[model samples]
Target: MPHGFPIYPWLCLLFTYIRGLNSTVGESRMKSLLLKPRSCSRVLQGHPWVFAGEVQDLLPGSENGKTVVLRDSRKRILGSGVYNQNSKIIWRRYAWNKVPFSMQFIRKSIEKAIQRRPVETCRRLVWSESDLLPGLVVDQYGDALVVQALTLAIDMRLPAIATILQELTNAKAVVFRNDASVRKLEGLETYVGTFNDQVLEPLNLDIDGLSYQLDLLKGQKTGFYLDQREQHALVSTFAKGGAVLDAFCNQGAFALQCAKAGAKSVIGIDSSDTAVQLARYNAKENRLEATFEVENVFDYFTNNRDERFDLIVLDPPPFARSHAQVEGALKGYKEINLRAIKALNPGGILATYTCSQAFSMEVFEDLVSGAASDARRTIQILHHCYQAKDHPILLTMPESAYLHGLILEAD
Candidate 1:
């Protein structure tokens, strides 16, 4: 309209702006992946992971932390995912369509994940791929939120995640517990940090009427095992007037709950001196009468042959982290179950759990059966437990359901 000023110069400027816009769009377009014939079957079945072997071709510039649109060999659209050339899991699907990897997407995903779980003082907000945000886990403890970024894509977006979480939850602090060994599988280095330059300290939280001091900075798996929150109360229901033993007890959650439930006696054992000391401190903080000892559970069982308990809880860390270690993990599970069965009084209860994703429930149950057979004890399955509701399991991905437990009665 300003023809008098300079019509030719204005037209030239408009053309240049259009070219720049097109260039930006081209640069931002998502890279794509073509999958092998049968590889698409798993993606079609709703699984979210695609290994390197499954990928037929990857577009140029499809590097780690880049989002890719996945397609089957037949050119059919499969989904969109984050590409990681450095990881065996080359692709982690986040949506069934081409989705932009942006702050809005991350914020919406986190919001939806939070909405899925019930409001609680402590709970898992985002559970890795189960919540459609692969390799990202967010756990809330009171006013603090602990996050873990296991994949390169998610790790790169940590600042965005922290900002979104802070905005949504109004949390006092957001701490990163990215020190899990599993991060190595994704080629991520381990380090811990906090959002907003806040200091990481031991947080005192009262969960289910039990007090706990959590060291989110240097503690185990985001300070506490929140996945077993439901199991704590469930196991405590059988503790009244009974002798209780919590093997591999970290911070004495189960033992403290058992003692609070009026158990005749409660003893918690762990190989970590720091854990035992913290457990003792937790017990004293709660004014609960329980014993904490720094000793290997296997050694405790072997040395205290005369010690029998009415209820025993075996919640050990994963003995198997990969498929190669499953056989050894099974043997370890069998030995623990067999020992617990032998150590139980007649009609006593045994609650055992395996956090290893490699061990399926069928495999776990079979091992427990073998243990009972070896111990020559009649075993009755009381309850089959899983991770708490907040840590939901995606039906299609078995790995999402890592924590599996079975309560039994041995006679």
Candidate 2:
């Protein structure tokens, strides 16, 4: 062997050749998904979803919860996405170029999402598609992080996600809140537990001087609703020196905020007895004077004809989860708004909200308008509200902007 004659150069050349050959072979064997000729525009416009009808064919060897190359009818490579044939959203693009859905990619995505928001004790660290992680949500509560995987792809990689979250947040506990109904679309089961099956005690959080004790295991929507943190402060501005009634008051957040703002009297109504009890506990913990009752808000509005309030807050849960429910949701909105308008004292303020993504701003505004008309009351829109900044909305995805509200003053 001629010592160091030209051996190093030859070896480098051979390695490069083999690497290129392996890359070509890997590309040929990767699963491919083709879209109809005209169906490529939406994906090109940066929208992540490719519906079932848009897909021309998912070539053989494709597997659910795995990455697949997307192509147009003309065989032009469009991008790469996670494929789930069982879901109406057949593909959800994660990259505009060929890339594997590997652990490193997931780690970088999760880290970038967490860095996008302010470092707060309690906040939404990641917001599903808005953060470029479709069907994934992470909420930080003190030292605990609650994660929800709503898609088969993310669900299959939960352990990796947990490890990455623990490393990034240094969280003492990581809980899974995977009970959302949307998981049914991906053919995934709904369940909740901690990472590594470790038990986590109830988490206590303090936001803007208010404290809350939440059971991340048994509570609703990742233990508590972090989206309304901004609205609680915004609505409290109008509560001073007035009687404030918080309807549909889950955990009595609005009622407590009002009491803290020095409202003359604060009353909260909720149908959930447990929620009412928690609300009462929260009021006592904060040393705020507020009354909580376990009664249906609708019935309370209907039966308490003579009751009135200077400020009425109606922050009901989502009424419409799908297009089919939009009609009935509108009716429900009108009924609740009508009763609230009637229950308001002259010149009272009504802070109403809808978390339903199916209802557009125009439709929601129209429903409120119809309610005011039927109740024969004139109102002025004083303020417009949306989810807190922590939950960023992707402009291209309308569904990301789910929570919207209006603060109105009745004359």
Best by lDDT: 1
- Candidate 2 per-residue lDDT, tens place, 1-411, comes to 112223453354345334332222243556888888777457767688888888777544237777788888888888877778889888887777888776677778888988888888999998887776778899999899898989877776666677789999999888888778998899776777777668777756787789988998888788887899999999999999999999999888899999999999999999999999999999999999999999998999878988989999999989899999999999999999999999899989999999999977778889999999999999999988889998997777777788989999999
lDDT of 1 by residue, 51-136 (tens): 88887865554366767888888888788888888788888898888776666677788889988888988889999888888899
**Reference-based lDDT, each prediction:** 0.86, 0.84
Compared with the true structure, model 2 gives a TM-score of: 0.91
Reference-based TM-score of each model = 0.92, 0.91
Q: What is the lDDT of residue 337 in candidate 2?
A: 96
Off by over 4 Å in 2: 1-29, 40-44, 59-62
Model 2's C-alpha root-mean-square deviation from the true structure amounts to 10.0
lDDT of 2: 0.84
* Candidate 2 displacement at residue 7 in angstroms: 55
Model 2 residue 346 lDDT score = 94
